[model samples]
Target: MSNLAARLRARRAHTRTRRAVSKAIDTATTTTMRDELITLAQTHGYQKSKPRV
Candidate 1:
């Protein structure tokens, strides 16, 4: 019983760590893509339009 509990705990910890790493990677990818888009737009002389209320 103790061994099973230990295994479960380790698996949970690994899952949590994997999720955190995946989230971080996703965020970094999004940021990089956004930066690239902004650069491309700037190169094309695209201006940001104001949002209409």
Candidate 2:
């Protein structure tokens, strides 16, 4: 039915948008979190900081 098809399309669109948004947020947050963890370790002498030339 046309109505069913329309509903399916809308649902798919919503799912795709949600997935894309979550993926974007995940990348940004994970990047900062990883950086923070590495810095924290270095500060506590658990990890050494690489010298920047």
Candidate 3:
């Protein structure tokens, strides 16, 4: 009984951790996209050369 309970607790904790990571990844992706869009918007000008690495 104790072992089964421990396994269940561990599974639940793992699920919660995965969910948190997924949310964090989604947030980071959205922020990055927003920043890129803003940067692109700011670069709209009459004379501008493409940035080369």
Candidate 4:
């Protein structure tokens, strides 16, 4: 019983860590893409337009 409980705890911790790492990677990728897009728009003399309601 104790061994099973330990295994379960370890698995949960591993899952949590994996999820955090995945989220961090996703956030970094999004930020990098956004920066690249802004740079590209600036190079092409494009300004951000306001959204219409």
Predictions in order: lDDT:
0.60, 0.60, 0.56, 0.61
lDDT of 2 by residue, 1-53 (tens): 99999999998876676555444444655778757755655564445323469
- Reference-based lDDT, residue 38, model 2: 57
Global lDDT of model 2: 0.60
Q: In model 1, where is the ten-residue run with the lowest total lDDT?
A: 42-51
List clashing residue pairs in candidate 1. none
Better of 1 and 3 by TM-score: 3
Model 2 residue 24 CA deviation in Å: 0.4
Off by over 4 Å in 3: 29-53
Per-residue lDDT of 1-53 in model 3, one digit per residue for the tens?
A: 99999999998876676555444444655778746544554454212234469
Residue pairs clashing, model 4: none
Stretches > 4 Å off in candidate 2: 29-53
Residues 8-39 of candidate 4 have per-residue lDDT tens digits of 99988766765554444446557787576566
The positional error of residue 18 in candidate 3, measured at the CA in angstroms, is 0.1
TM-score of 4: 0.53
TM-score of 1: 0.53
